[model samples]
Target: MDVIGGKWKALILWELENYGVRRFGELRRGLPGVSEKMLIQQLRELEEDGIVTREVYREVPPRVEYQLTELGTALNRALEPLGDWGRDRIERIGANRVHPVTT
Candidate 1:
């Protein structure tokens, strides 16, 4: 869970799940405001955790792409409920100016 316990990880996973496989540059472009260094670190961590697969093409410029593994896909599915809950909460908060109390 630690691997996915960051602000960017879930967003990254969601983008990957929706977009299928993506190149490093493409992922970076998809996620605005994410630094290149942070993206690299997160991708490395995900790859090391066996949740994301990184493929390197033996080309002149060395193309690379990242995709989620089966485990990662399952994890995303598990997080769907939480994601929906968050979306609903956001919508409710938008509808009602009353701020939600934080514990």
Candidate 2:
């Protein structure tokens, strides 16, 4: 939970799960509004948490790609229902205009 708690972590994992393998630039492009620094930080954290595997290709430009590990895939599955529930809740609340104040 700690690893996937970040704002962009789950989204990143979902992207990887859907896309299979993706380069850093690709991920950055896919997730608009995520700064490069934040993307790097989140990717590093995910890698450290054993949720993502980063592979580097020994090429002239040094190609790199990220993919979800087995653990990450399992986590993704677990979070899917939560995501659906959240979306449904948000839609319901939006329709009702139930805006809770935060302090």
Candidate 3:
């Protein structure tokens, strides 16, 4: 739970799952609220946890991309039920009535 537990990490994983391979700029754009430094930190943690893979390419501008590992896919599958339950709860109780749970 600690691995994927964070305000932005799960969102980052969702973005990666939605988009196959994403560059730093792409991820930054996708998650406008996240600071670049925080994104970098979260991505490094994810990579270290074996949930994400970072690829670097030798190019004029130096390109780097992030993709989900097999473990990440499994993690996402595990999270789907929770996500559904949250959505259902929100639909049933309404967003204002649903209290956000913190770690």
**Top model by TM-score, which number?**
1
Which segments of candidate 3 are over 4 A away from where they belong? 95-103
Top lDDT prediction, candidate number? 2
Compared to the true structure, candidate 2 yields what TM-score? 0.87
lDDT for each residue of candidate 1 in 1-103, tens digit (9 for 90 to 100): 7979777899889989999999999999999999999999999999999889999999999999999999899989999999999999889988676765567
lDDT of each: 0.92, 0.93, 0.92
List of clashing residue pairs for candidate 1: none
Instruction: Please provide TM-scores, in order, for all candidate models, with all chains considered together.
Output: 0.91, 0.87, 0.87
* lDDT (tens digit, per residue) of candidate 2 on 6-60: 7999999989999999999999999999999999999999999999999999999
The digit string of per-residue lDDT tens for model 3 on 80-101 reads: 9999998897786775457654
**Candidate 1 — which residues are off by over 4 angstroms?**
98-103
- Kindly state the number of residue pairs that clash in model 3: 0
Off by over 4 Å in 2: 97-103
What is the Cα-based lDDT of residue 44 in candidate 2? 96
Report how far residue 74 has shifted in candidate 2, in Å.
0.3
- Name the weakest run of 10 consecutive residues (lDDT summed) in model 1: 94-103
